[model samples]
Target: MDGYRGFLGLLVSALLVGFLSVLFTLIWVLHYREGLGWDGSALEFNWHPVLVVTGLVFIQGIAIIVYRLPWTWKCSKLLMKCIHAGLNAVAAILAVISLVAVFDFHNARSIPNMYSLHSWIGLTVVILYILQLLLGFFAFLVPLAPLSLRAFLMPLHIYSGLLIFGIVIASALTGVTEKLFFALTKPAYSTFPPEGVFTNTLGLLILVFGALIFWIVTRPQWKRPKEPNSVLLQPNGGTPEGVEGSMAINFGKADSESNNEAAARKRNLPLDEAGQRSTL
Candidate 1:
């Protein structure tokens, strides 16, 4: 409660703005500049920015933060995991289709591929995003790795995800600007035409959304509180014997729990001399 007061509301508004802004930009592209479809025409290229912004950047943001939502607190950890994995999977599929759209458009027009900064960054982000999703699925979803392995990787995964998200948003912003210039050059983009203003505003909104997401996910105080008394239920409709602590966190280092009292003193979290987590 101490840490959640102001930030959650900020997250909700940020999410809405980010999502709507992306949707607006996609519509703007399809409606005014290039109508969306996959007929291997210039119009087909429009689908790339739309899907990458919506799926890779916007939808992916929600997937990463689903666990932080207040409504998810009472839900089982397994349920949240499923939601996370499923959202990410859908985002990845959309990203793939968007990439295909662009490549097809380029090939049809004899345009060389990966020439711009935006393309390079977008491709890199997608590759890394796919890798991250695969690793996360095996590590956290199935519990295939040792607790220590998951522990070491968890921080990396979170940090890399945030980084990838930022890069993707940045790339999308540049892409939007580029599209505005090339597609609306009848009056010139430097004159601050309506298209320019609208696209730039959409890009700025995406930036704001990315900032809020990073804040919500990385702020130490925003971390979900442990449910100390939650029982670990097994698949056989029975509680795991002698297992009576929060399974809220996945893949905590078992060896470290043995030392929570002695050496597990982390900022914003404390452990008693008995190795039990302190409520404070």
Candidate 2:
């Protein structure tokens, strides 16, 4: 299980690292295009599609944290069960929202109001998501916490949350800035270029930092003293016995009345009977 989990963690970490790298490269490309004074044709206002997809990603990020919390805290089984149910409920709602966005986008349906709504709501969600992540971290220190919960999910939660934050913040900033620019200047993509480069670079830096943190937290240390083993049974008729006493008691004759009677009968036998008994 540990090996499987380690593989999963490495896979996720690699994917996130790759994603951040791509995002950074794109951001740089966008900035370079803008610096070179290229027309906004290279930049389009099609981020709504990306936003819808990424919003679902954000939801996944939140779900990971929420699902992990109870396990990390070693909460009561009932509480953990309840939390699982609640998280599932929230995930269902988000899933519906994501589906609606997908269909809406496909049908060429534009909700100008929804654009603002999704933006603000997403920003709020990201903030809470970050807070939940912070709390999820505390779960690691508690030994009673489930290993799968911490070892497998925690790093993903951290990395995913950071990535989501970067993406959402960039999306929000670019969105608001573009809107303002359009309101003031004009509806030309030339006025403001996509800031993907800066956002991506920021995300990469965050991923690196997160990796460093994970290493620091999970590094091995000297072993702790084990609990003293409890004595489950005793020798010498239930009395406490040290090692030597326990050995002696096992090797000695029975201390019961039956053994004493048998000894007395042997001693009382006549010499001839004793000799015959001994020969027998």
Candidate 3:
């Protein structure tokens, strides 16, 4: 089972890398050929997809799977939780910057904001994402929320997270489609340019990557497991299950040794084996 999970993990990695590769290919072929900048230019618009792909798509997926990583098992749960929250925070920040860049570019061009289907869904998802981060932090990271509340909200958090991830990917695909339709003039926009093909491929990879990540995260078999004799950690220091099991086995061995010694003494044949006793 573990081996299979490991193989699945490799598949997930490949899918994620492919997603980023396709995304970068689109960006380079369509956007970066012009150059990148933060000021109010077409170049500035590139940040939106770059940050969304790097932070929301790539880093975000990595953040979601921190607990699933086998090496993380040795570390304290709280530590992993911290890394989880931190990665999420970084992604959220980048996503926000992406949004800002889009709005800024639109305003500079005297274009309307939140007017398109892509913008509507994108903005809503971003708002929901920020709220999700807040809920997660309070529920799991801090004692701000009651542990009961945290437990109650946890499943909802997981469910909503996967759903929102899907929504973001969908919005991104639409946004890319919209960009190709609106922005491109050269290479004849209607005649299926190379950039158009790459953009569609990027969108497909996003779906595949999202599915793989969602699968690995939700699968019960892939979840972290406590060993049979795994020790439980507590503030006051507790005895390990492995030590308890070992002690019981040692006690049984000692009892068997004592029993044999007593039987040998009772035989009283120079305290030797049956062969020596028979010879004597």
**lDDT, candidates in the order shown:** 0.79, 0.43, 0.76
List residue ranges in candidate 2 displaced over 4 A: 1-55, 65-74, 109-194, 198-280
Could you say which candidate leads in lDDT? 1
Error of 2 at 206 (Å): 9.9
Report the Cα lDDT for candidate 1: 0.79
- Model 2: per-residue lDDT, tens digit, 1-280? 2344553464466446535543543454354333222122322233332332233333333333332322234444335435533553454454445344434543453435335654566545545554543445355433244444455665775575556545544544444444434333333444443343344344444445345334322333311112233222333254332343455455554556668888888787777697898999
Pairs that clash in candidate 3 = none
Clash count of each predicted structure: 0, 3, 0
So what's the TM-score on candidate 3? 0.75
Residues 195-279, model 3: lDDT tens digits = 7777767777777777777777877876877555544333233222334545655677999999999987888765467768688
Q: Can you rank all candidates by lDDT, best first?
A: 1, 3, 2
Model 1 lDDT, residue 91, Cα: 94
User: What is the C-alpha local distance difference test score of candidate 2?
Assistant: 0.43
Could you list the CA RMSD of all candidates, in the order they appear? 13.2, 16.4, 9.8
Model 1: residue 276 alpha-carbon error in angstroms? 50
Candidate 1: residue pairs that collide: none
